[model samples]
Target: MDEIIRAAGALLGQSLRYPVDLGGSSRSTVLRCRTATGGSVIVKAFADDPEARRAYTGETAGLSLGLAGPELLAADIERRLLVMADLGDVPTLADLLLGTDPKAAERGLLEWARGLGRLAACSVQRRAEFAALWQHHGQGLPSWEDEPWQRQNVDAFLDLLTECGLTAPPGLADELTAVGTAGGERYPGFTPGDTCPDNNLITPEGLRLIDFEAAGYQSVFLTAAYCRMPFSSCWCVYQLPADLAQRIEECYQFEVVTQYPDLAEEELWQAGMAQAVVVWTVDTTLRLLRRALPQDGRMHRTRRPVPTRRQVLRHRWTSALQLTGYPAFTSTMRLLLSELAAGWDVPELPGYPAFRAGAGPEAVQTVNSRGPETAGG
Candidate 1:
């Protein structure tokens, strides 16, 4: 223990106090530590993997907004160790969401978005550099689109539909393929590949975003893909109050409009749905099929699980059908709807009860009685 502390101190150029883990990504260990200099700091030590160095570089540059970038206290690039100021009062948006008051939660979420907007606007000049960083860190690598992560999701949804034995509206896969491909190209602003609620931080000053390992330059619509994961949950989207979902969309749109005036209303609406397909496709595969049938896990789009494919197509259909009625972006939405319907012929798979709370956010949304707006996501 002493030797480890000594090593940390030597690396930090100060005496080491104690270390407290702040759980973060699989690639880095985030810690709360005190330096002999009598100051607190947040330390991020990369795993054995060297890719983390590029991530750190991107995050450092991303923090140029000057609001929440922790001070770079020390770094040992060879060891993949990084130490910075620990912003003490900041709680992640996920933590803040536990608040009892719905209004407060909404406000907090909005604040988080505001901080993100600031980052997006200010970081515009670093666009090329940011893209380069993602490429270096594997953030820009095409998603394991055909990997088991995707197939599993498709399987889970199909299984759920089979269990319910609902006469599913047809053509799900075609719609998703079209939307996914098109949305990837058209989204407006930078897409933070990792926009899970946990990635947002709320400080007394407002919201500050952290964890830029997956931060990269992408079409703005792709950003919505990151944000729309909650809707894919059968539970949260269905169970949560409708007002909450509406507020979320409003806040998200407000931020986008504020950042890019040319952002057309149709574009905003299309981006939201387009991103929705991207997120749902990925999350379902990663979280669902992977869990039920581990051995079959090969990359998503690559290996096809005939059974699981039907289930995922079902969920995708549920989402697309719900969005079909909305007035905006009818043409594009129709395109997705038609594509989604094409998958109805897939044979149903049997396994896993329709997602319940334990199934994750998609299941959670389903329980809420929220509109397809929230549920289909």
Candidate 2:
């Protein structure tokens, strides 16, 4: 901590004190520090590792674009340290959803989608610029675009299926190859990377995106999947009322349609979105299946009132079945559902806490009857 603080202080020409450790993952250490001028700044120092260096590159490059996130105050590339303007103690979207107010949660969802879409639409033309910036800040490492992440995920999932005594559906590979093409390529857009519930601040001004550690250009459909799956990679996963979810999806769709009018086409939009969802579903299982198979645990380490791994997987499988045109992927999901999830004896995922039946005064209408919540232990 002292080492990072001294490096940051040197870059800013001032001493930073009273560090409040804002828990960062293995890749970095984040602190809210009091500057000499009585102001505050966020100081993040990356670990001396490739993963951390890459994250530093992405964040510095992303924020440098002035696309979104807090202002970059100072940086020391050699030290992999960043001093950014403090966003202060604002409540995040997670706070709203986990709280008792349904109205605030619903509002935040719609606005969050809209803000993200606008960010994507405006960034469509800056791909080359982003690539150049990435190259500049990156430690000569391959960018997300160069990495075959989806293919790797597919391969990993296939291996996982074999371990679980399951077989891939016959057409799954062909189907994934088909729809998966040109997701980001067709309608590429910039995003803060990890737009998870806890990563964004919902301030009085509006949604302030934080954590560009995963920042880069990718498929707009990937972002869309976040809404459809009700947050694809986040720990705040829970069932949103179908109607509300659709409204949130539409909110994003309308914004992006302004940039890529073709997204307005039902067939193209459906196909791309379905593909992104399929890949993400594979990703979710690949990430959680083995761990979940052993024992159910909270999705987050410290966040309270979070859903369990089994609940999230069950929800992922059930919702994935609603998607069509990926018959093999669909079958794969079914196999996981019957073979693995069945043995777990976990209940189907329930609605967002704010929208659950009989939620307090601010609750909206009941979730459009999705049958008796899957009964289980």
Candidate whose lDDT is highest: 2
**Among all windows of ten consecutive residues in candidate 1, which has the lowest summed lDDT?**
366-375
Q: Estimate, for each residue in 1-377, the C-alpha lDDT of model 1 and write its tens digit.
A: 35445555787778877876665455676667787777787777666544555555555444432444556566554555666677674545443343334455566656655555555554555656654543443433332222323334444544544553333336544444344433433433454445544455566766655565544554445444333434243222212344554555456656666656655477557655554555464455335433333233211221111133334434444444455433332333344335433434544332222222233221111111111111112
lDDT of 2 at 56: 92
Give the 10-residue window scoring lowest on summed lDDT in candidate 2.
368-377
Poorly placed runs, candidate 1 (over 4 Å): 1-12, 50-69, 132-177, 180-188, 225-239, 292-320, 325-377
Q: How high is the CA lDDT of each candidate model?
A: 0.47, 0.81
lDDT per residue as tens, model 2, 1-377 = 99889899998999999998877777888888999999999899988888788889889889888877899988878888989999888777777777688898899898899989999999988889888888877777777778857767766877888999888879777776665533877788998888887776788888888889878888999998888888888777888989999999999999999999999999998888888888888878878878788898878765656788898898888889988777788888888888888887767787888777676643222211111111111
Candidate 2 clash figure, as a count = 0
What is the clash count of model 1?
Answer: 62
Residue 345's lDDT in candidate 2: 73
